[model samples]
Target: MNPATRSAFPGFAWSLSRQKTLAECPRRYAYEYYFSHNGWLADASEETKRIYRLKKLTSLEMFFGSSLHNVIQNAISNYSKSRKIPRPDDLVRLVRSSLNAAYIDSTRHYGLWFDKPSRYTMFRDVYYGDGLPPDKIEEIRSRIGACAESFPKSKTFREISGGRNVRLMELERFRTLPFADVDVVVVMDIVYRDRDTGRWVVADWKTGKESAEDRTQLALYAMYLQKLYDIPSIRDITIRNEYLATGTWREYKLEPIDVDNTLYVLERSVMEMRRYMEDIDGNVPYELEAFPLTEYTRHCERCNFKELCGR
Candidate 1:
């Protein structure tokens, strides 16, 4: 262990994913770290522009998410219509206002995936699965419907917990210490205390489909949370995919072994990042990972990064 790794605070300093990325390739790290560039070439080719255009239509999917949010907000408002309990209507309005503000904030805001319409439609439609048996399709649709109906009322916190992007933890002994070295930080969606089990949970909001790889991301998040917060016996953690296209939410849990594996990976990543930062060799031009942006699944067609990735 590096001597600098020993902190008066018991938990880890950075999220595992952030550390992992830094270790994977320092040039990629520089782009993501200091520059805040997600490998996006603002001045893109015509083909990339076309793909971006098609992607814009998928913003239409927000119609489904906002429609359901409105429905649930209405339900909550009606539920509290008789009494003084708070409602989700304000939150819905706030989200809408923020999105509009973001649109206005952009200098040349065309929209998401502006170049690829058929790809967007095909991706969504296929995920909805035309080849499935009629009964199976109905069952899947019904599950999505149920999720749309139940999500706003289930395990919801009044306000997005931990605030916006970065959470602040006050170390009692380090009250006077200025945090100068900390540049990158991770923001999670929700934190839950199970009603029946009395266990702590960290829930991340995913707007895409769930996969085993997504579980790995959650484990990394959980391990960082445990290390940072000094929370122990932190067993059950989940990544909840609130699908925008289908108006559904699915939960994926992280097992103990997965958490341990992620931490092992994380520690090694941190050590490598520290080493790369100290390297004084000849200037090495930074290069983003070639496969890092590759379209691993059909879903890659929908990614905003697909054009930059040359997928």
Candidate 2:
């Protein structure tokens, strides 16, 4: 493929979430990172284009999470410069409006997405679910309200906007640090110094319930931040997950051993992913059969590539 054909994709990059996807469903992962490559081209195979369309589907929860995170990301970013914090009510209103727009788009934008999959949104709800139920819609709105209310009022957010010496604040930008001969990508929600505590903070916002893997993900991020920015001590970094939907926060202080374990895990994860690779140097993957599909109906039921998998 020409460079222009691959402009939208990063070619191949390792990430904690991408690793999780590989673990969750290798077939889906292959479709995502490999077969769908160059699927966006005008002269691409029909099957490849269809695969790319399915790949573009974002579930309702993911859609909402991204929407809210982006809004809050911009708010914090603007506050870092303007020192004017956004109102909780305004954020809530914006989220509700966006939700409405997305719901309509999911229902009505099929033709547009068919013409240009990358330009328009393709929601998994409409594709897989045929759109969510009324109760589900209300539940999403309720969660959005809670998260929006919690953010501008949360202790961590308050301090960030409460006029402190914020430095090295990274938000909504993809950053990479070379590891094990691969580019490890991380899109950190926010990373900055507390200034008062003389500690570096990696704050990750959560829209849904907590996961056991969250600690590991945070640890990976913390390690990446430390090495990328050349922070002196590993213990000086603080990992936090702000559970916005519930208005709760938790912090994990990284010890030297934590960073060591994270690196070990990262190395193992990278090795596991390479098992399906046909060419490690070129970042090429093997045949579809090499990546087995999961037998679990629960996972496939809501998956975007269900049709392709014949789930």
C-alpha local distance difference test of each model? 0.42, 0.81
User: What tens digits encode model 2's per-residue C-alpha lDDT throughout 135-182?
Assistant: 877888899889988998776787676677767564547877787687
Output the number of the lDDT-best candidate.
Answer: 2
Candidate 1 segments whose C-alpha is farther than 4 A from its true place: 1-28, 35-90, 107-151, 156-185, 194-196, 224-232, 236-255, 271-311
Model 2, position 258: C-alpha lDDT score: 83
Score candidate 2 by lDDT: 0.81
lDDT of 1 by residue, 124-170 (tens): 23222322245744543454444443345454432222232322222
Model 2 lDDT, residue 83, Cα: 77
Tell me how far the alpha carbon of residue 205 in candidate 2 is from the true structure, in angstroms, after superposition: 0.8
Q: Provide the global lDDT of candidate 1 against the true structure.
A: 0.42
